[model samples]
Target: MDVLCESAPNDDDCGTRYSSSSSEDDERRDQGVAMTYMTLDSILNDNSRMFEFLRSFGVLANKYVCATCRKPMSCVKVATTRCGDGLMWRCAKDKVWRSVRKGTWFEKSKIKLKSIVLLTYCFCMRKSVQSTCRITGLSDKTVVDWFLSCREICSALMKKRGKIGGPGVVVEFGESSFGSNKYDKGRWMAEVWVWGAVVCGKDHGELVLNVVEKRDARTLQWFIEEHVENGTVIYSDKWDSYEDAEEFDLQSFAADHNYQFRNKVTGTMERYWKEVKRVLEGGKRRRSGLQSHLDEYIWRESVFVHGCAFHSFMQSVGALYVPRVED
Candidate 1:
């Protein structure tokens, strides 16, 4: 909710890149099984192109209805103004004026729309913060803040959607620890435990990454019951905590890493941890924001099967901001 910039800059200085036919190209490029880097020219040619694209996906609303009078409002700004760049609207009933970005993620945001959109693309792409900062010409703090916000939206949506694996599905379960032993003897020592699972698919799969307090049987059981579906084939290493998984109506299988009959599903999750740590640069000083990093990793993994990760994420933004019963 906080704007990470000192002041919002004009469109030309925002470093937004786009091509005239880039939207069509995006549609075509996104059809691949793996996500590829989009050229800046292929991303957005003009400022309004991104706005129009969001609208086409129903991420942005068709009408700007007034909140005060509940009537469809008409634009009060000049025809040439960007829709999201502080354009004004006039209520049909009360004749009151309102800023277009009054209540959305763009509200109180001091970053350009194009930069925001590009930052989102970079996040979905799982690019490093330093890399994204260089590309967008944004401060490291600003880009990190924006990436965390997007992760918040992804986390909220994942929670709303509930558990992943179901009947006949193999859900790999694992517990891992992060942080170095050099700090272990000092007051700065931090032991971070992360419990995670993956619903393995042939090409791409969904994952659940949770930061838990303890790695005990009680804790693991509670996490599994809360986040995994009933009758799922839960696979894991021979950890003592997972020994009682069958007590919870799940098909539990345990194996040792040295054994030939190791579970492939759990293997994938191990590789995932490597990729996650690699992207976060070993996640050394990010103890406080570990969950956000996990959320970003999970969300990025979920999008590999789909062509347009950015568009899918944009569609999620509307529901992410909507007031939910749980919230």
Candidate 2:
């Protein structure tokens, strides 16, 4: 029996010996051994490799520390099964011993890391959660939970870096209303007004969306002050609420539709508003959780502008090393 180092090349590295009896069986066994070695190598080299490596060793490798308890984990094997796609490894830890578990923003989730990566890619590409579930072959509940977990991560990222658009940034601001039930006599149906601003640049400015109680001067000014810096150039349509721009020191300019404003120069903000509204209304569920949902919408828009894939963004987010207490 040849013992191969974990990093060594597969069975092909070893010289073959012919056994007169069952030569075919010997060849098949060698092939199987080679394939298994290759799979292990691939897993070890996987960029997204998380806890599985530690679990395979039967001791948490000190790196896969519990995010909550800050202690190394011990793999408590639960069950093993093979799905149509591949093998499944399920493990459990004491609630106290666990922290944010693999594949979750919280501790101790059973979802696979690969599934999370796939779902994140789908999300960054603007695929609906239902569509993502279909693509990943996950249940609706699982997909939704993953999405919410990702949203929490995204929110933490956004909070750490305050106000994306900064000094010398030129921003275009706009507002749109959805879920208005004027025809239904406006009983319990009130209009959900979304105020959006996109910085104007070679690409669209990182988008900011806020759900405003009303699109009044106070609200608009608040949005501008919160997201944009003073002395920034702001362009918008002629709205009375924007009249008090002098107080904010914002170089406010009104777009002239009669002049056929080009999208490259003047209509960038409007374009973002259109895109966000389209995405918000894309699903049949009609997002009723207004505030947090709008935050997520803005997050998606910003991600689109930054051209970040979901997993990459998540890794970059982790690099920020923000304290979990703030989250």
Candidate 3:
């Protein structure tokens, strides 16, 4: 045996090699951790923690004064609590908490704050109210109420924010019908005729659905004029109602698609109509309060645009209301 102890396999060298390998593994793990933290899904999943962490930065506070009485709300209770799913609060007052704003929408709703937050998230995520109810384990009626409250808020916010169109904006407008009745050859069946407009650049538009007596040019034109600004470049499917656009100084284009408006410019508005139809016709029996319920669906659709951060978008929408204090 050349010295009978082969120098113990160079203990220092082996230790150094092992340390180097461990260091490399640690670096790889750190990289993976960094990548995960940078993803939107990860952020959304951890929204509760993120919100709580953000409180330290003073993001949640009693900045909103009551819109009704104009009194400065003194306290804000921000927390993540559970009921149906998980509720995140940005409420005013300490003990018996209430949202800082009021009167515009979501007023006096007894639903848990978490339910509202989850409902809003689902709605923004394109989940229908029925699906939202199922996922959150809430009653259909409660889900409908949440939808209505959201819609009321959206409508109020949009009006306060002003007309959807800015100057020289090309806005596409169209009408579509939803719901059906087989009893009266679908004539006696109540149908909702939806009028919608989409602005080209601004992620802003309006939709109004009602039980229409007819779909004439006057009705269509009135709907367009009410929602879109004058002088917008309007496109429609050769409907006579659109023929009078020249009077309103709106540059008009007639699409060749009959009974179906196929202008790509109008695609967003058309998709919105389709989404509304899906909500109404999807398996569930049409509720008696469908129109009132649909208002929230429309509002939710309008607010959730591509590239918008859903949570922050809702917060901004929430901020649009001046808080109303009850006496």
Candidate 4:
């Protein structure tokens, strides 16, 4: 929640892009599958458009009920204002004033709505904080905090998506250590071990990557039980900790790394481990923030693999911030 959105500067720069029906189609491919791609330049150049974009998706509140009036408020533009967009929620009945962003995800933000959208886009693209700062004119701290918020969003999404693989599903899993004594700001850091798994034989399988204190049976079993469903076909290396996998009613298979990384009968987790290591190694953060990066990596693989990264992420923003009506 360390959001640092700076207020938008151009108060009168509202555009009519939101009025166009075709604007929502930007994140789609001709084949109907989502392929969210929007340029930073395109987002940075507009303030009102981003507000409208978020409004279209309900990330920003569409309407408000006045506390005093107890009726719906109209979004009216003030003649002179500096709080990002010029609009505010106004109730004609009681002369009560409210922010259009009130009670929404953007309520506490100090930056333009467009910048928030741009930040999510940058996160989706895996852009560095420095480069994102240059592109979005956001401070490093702001970018870092927003990126962390994005990671938190990823973690929440993962929990909501629930565990991966089920009965009759093949799951590939492994354990690996991440650390570098060679150079981490010229100091040695502790090794961080992570247990990772994926739905095998699929380009975009369900995933689970968790940082563990140790790789013992009790420790690994805790995460394994949490992240994976029972009755899954679990493939792994010959790690003794997984001896009790069947105790949880799981179907377990082991590969002997001494002979080969993979064999027709046993090994399937080699490629999955390679992908996880590749992502973890690509990060520039310290061991402390490794879990965030790993969570974000798993989230991206879960979402972006469907070719709907930015769009899907924005929808998640809407779902989280928008109040739902109970049936």
Best by TM-score: 4
TM-score of each: 0.71, 0.57, 0.50, 0.77
Per-residue lDDT for 180-219 in model 4, tens only? Answer: 4455557766677777878877766677877888676667
- Model 1: how far residue 140 lies from native, Å: 2.6
Best by lDDT: 4
Q: What are the per-residue Cα lDDT tens digits for candidate 2 across 30-74?
A: 222111223333443332233343222222222344545555444
lDDT scores of the candidates, listed in order: 0.62, 0.49, 0.46, 0.64
Per-residue CA lDDT of model 3 for 164-276, tens digit only, reads: 55345666666766555553334445565656666654444555544445666666646654565544566555444445553532234222211223344547667666666
Which pairs of residues collide in model 2? 101-107, 199-205
lDDT of 1 by residue, 101-179 (tens): 5566666688866688778878776667899998889999999899888888877777776787776678787777777
Badly placed stretches (over 4 Å) of model 4 are 1-48, 79-82, 241-268, 282-284, 323-327
Say what the RMSD of model 4 is.
Answer: 7.3
What lDDT does candidate 3 reach at residue 194?
53
- Superposition TM-score, candidate 3 onto the true structure: 0.50
> In candidate 2, residue 213 scores what lDDT?
80
For every candidate, C-alpha RMSD to the true structure in Å:
8.2, 12.4, 15.7, 7.3
Superposed Cα deviation of residue 63, candidate 2 (Å): 2.4
- lDDT score for residue 283 of model 4: 33
